[model samples]
Target: MSVCKERAWKTLEELSFIRVAGTQEELKAAQYLKNECEKAGINAEIEEFEIDMPVISKATFEVLEPYKKEYHVIGIGKSGTTDENGIETELVYIENAVDVHLNHVKGKICLLHGRLNPELSEKLIKAGAVGTISIAGSFYDEKSIADELRPRNTFGKGGQLPGLVMHISDAEELVRSHPAKVRMVLLQDAEKKGISHNVVATIEGSDLKDEILTLSAHYDSVPYSKGAWDNATGSITVLEMMHYFAKHQPRRTVKAVWCGSEEIGLVGSRKYCETHKDEMDKTIFNINFDMTGVTLGHEICCVSASNDVMHAIEYLAKLENNALECKLDTYSSDSTSFAGAGVPACTFARLAPMGGAQIHNHYDTMEHLDPDSFMITLNFALHFAKQLVNTTTNLIPRKFDEVITKKLEERKKWFSEEKDEKKKESEENKDEKTKEEEKK
Candidate 1:
């Protein structure tokens, strides 16, 4: 595959911007990238959808009454209107709101950490919380916040919740502000019902038009983080790959997808899969690239689609360069969204993890990035994509091994279960201590 440094860098520069949730910034970036694709003679379109309530970008937290220390809400916060005077509520650390009680939080402000447990995020709203906060964890903090974190969509179903997020440090400071009375205001002025967009480019196959190979990277991201290494790099990687595939048509219908809203809970990729059900059924292979910035300790492991797509990627990796690091992503990237739907899919990204904060922070500016290893990943991905595009042989449709996927899910479930058990035990011990003190 031909590597176009200029074009790749060009696309990167175009998208190296702050496309916060549902803002015109994202639209502008997606449109510009679409133009770049069109210039390359590849048809590209924006898959547009409205946000439930478009997130309010700039939100401020000030401790009024006594002290006034500003706290930056970690990510795209709840979209709502609050009193200009700010809402007063007792700040309490509700360990895991999802796993614990929500009703006790009524008429109070709640700060939740310990991962964005689904049960927790929704509980705050049910418990009548004025606002909700999620402290950053060791999870994919960067990418997850920018693109993956989202309130579970309850469309055509049930009630919704209001919430936002904060980084761990910010959350800790607020939590430590015991007896800290403050006014928390969330500015949620604008919102679109449900708008989302998907960016796709197609290259006509020379011989086989029916068979397809999709090299996908979600183009959309979350707030509080710039999704450069998380996915801007992945999107640019696809753009550069298009340059090669367009110049040399592959045997299979090769498509490059820059899916939108992947961060806010796989909305973009999930919707794309649903809309293109027919095309997806015919999809022989889907190779997803996310966080391929080549870190020192991380191996580029392949979470292969059960049907041997890993073998293809492996073969291609060896064929291209054996220096590539192989990795295993059980609960990472947009590929899981596809895999969960029973589609044959896998994820590829940088081996190193700053808990995914490289392009996540203000520091993600391209000026501070390391492209040495990034180039290696780009080259390897391009080669793998090219190999799939050129293959005339049909990939063996082996049922994606549910074992690995299942095991990962089970582990997550077990961890949560164990954590709850431990927390309960700790609570019991605290109760015993109170009784002893009373007796004394």
Candidate 2:
């Protein structure tokens, strides 16, 4: 069946409210997703969890000018005691907060180029950045991508300073507004704690029912970002796939997971795995779809650390693009949780920005989505699931190295066949040229 790009983009465009870590908007998106899954005929349900020192939406803040609201502080922030007047420090531009220069951040306000990586946030806080300023570009469509891309917008007050992230242009304008030793006095909610839930659905197989395969995507997004591409694309992709598969039916028991709080340190995936370690341990593989569909370039790349999984994914994407190569040992996504544990797993995405990173920008929106890419990914995943189901003897095979080696061997034969075809084409061209010269 044809999946309409206009319709898919419209779906993401309408849910501009979804953000990460259990906000009202996120819940709304979740409910909408659950409805979609049910409508498509998939059995779906919610799974909840709690995070200690959670940087959820409730611990919200904004830059106030003592009398008027100056900058709205979105997401998590420091909550304990502060220097009443809020630390007034000069702004320091951090090219990459994740790779922050410790010596330079001491007692200064930090301006980050992209979204915050939690690891970077902890390190920078430890480095002594009084606060943080982030730039969110215009192309951002999904909130999930923002949550993962941005530093949890959280702060643990009294750690020498606080942090806040905002759009690049808006931040530039905010920083320029009355630039005289600008002081940002924001609140930190270290004490506020809460709960978040993940929704899971299962399609049991009769044969190897004990073995399992998982398909995952975060249901949350950043507070301000609707998370269309960041994850609404991913989350929706899973539901759509689930609907299709449920009707078509696969051999292995497939679990469709709508993870929660994934935007914050993989909390949802981590918690879910922990809660179902027994069953998860039984899992042979996990297929993670983070971002799919693009109005611009469509470079569906596969990421996996295991040799076997990588070999399999790369084999699946062999005919994609010569310039766009699918990595064999790449492992960075919601699937990292399971993949890290040695359960053969990999992540699927439509595009990979030049080097080796996701298109971590707001421009990763519906405006840049291509429905054709989405359908390709959806169908490829469906076929891959079929292969995985058929290969019941080797889910997370005992030796991933062997798995990849075997797959690569097959690839060599395929490439040879391709080369032979090109040779024939060249020969045909030469023949045509010879005939023309003879006629002349």
User: Best candidate per lDDT, number?
Assistant: 1
Q: What is the lDDT of residue 122 in candidate 1?
A: 50
Global lDDT of each candidate: 0.64, 0.62
| lDDT tens digits by residue: candidate 2, 265-376 | 5778877887888886678888888777654445454554455556656666665422234666434457766654555666777664453223444444566566776677
> In terms of TM-score, which candidate is strongest?
1
Residue 309 displacement in candidate 1 (angstroms): 4.2
Q: Write the per-residue lDDT of candidate 1 for residues 157-200, one digit (tens) a residue.
A: 11233345656766766766674665566555433455667787
Worst 10 residues of 2 by lDDT: 58-67
lDDT of 1 at 159: 24
Candidate 2, number of clashes: 38
RMSD of each: 11.6, 19.9
RMSD of 1: 11.6
